[model samples]
Target: GGGWCSSDETCTYRLTNGLGSSKYYNETVFFGEIKSTNKTVNPDFYNWNRIVVEYCDSSSFMGKANHPKIISRGAQIFYAVMEELLEKGMASAKN
Candidate 1:
């Protein structure tokens, strides 16, 4: 499982990590331009899989979503890194 998150030659304004707009842990990131990110992409993005994102309002976590990921080239790279982590964890579990 591998994914990648990168901007195409056209992107020259901002940066971000994942897909599907702005999903965050505390608050939904709907505003501001994404400058940079450390969140890696999970292979689940390239293929079929499930993803859960914490959605909240101005107060707290309101709910969650179980859906597939739709990301850009940059976000895809991040997804790939996430895939590597998952694989490593799985392998370690067997050992």
Candidate 2:
């Protein structure tokens, strides 16, 4: 277990294990949509963000893009969409 403290509160943490890559899952979905359009897609969609939610066990799900709480890791899911976005240059520094 791990512990952390903030100006407001202290919290305890433990690791949770899960399967598959949430980042790859979300990226695949987004790229799939883009490829489906034969690369004639709008740039607006590229700016839009996506998330992959890790459900019970090793299961995963995708929620709406740019919406709040689209992804839930619970300290389990291995990949994070935000990290992927930054690495892929899909999101800007201002974002």
Per-candidate Cα lDDT values, in order, are 0.32, 0.35
Q: Any runs in candidate 2 off by more than 4 Å, and if so which?
A: 1-35, 39-79, 93-95
Best by TM-score: 2
RMSD of each: 16.8, 13.3
TM-score of 2: 0.23
Tens-digit lDDT track for model 1 on 31-56? 22232232234332333333333221
Which run of 10 residues does model 2 get worst, by summed lDDT? Answer: 6-15
Q: Write the per-residue lDDT of candidate 2 for residues 1-95, one digit (tens) a residue.
A: 12222212121111222232233233333345643433356444655545544332222322222213123333332346456666887555554
lDDT of 1: 0.32
For residue 81, model 2's alpha carbon misses the true position, in angstroms, by: 1.9
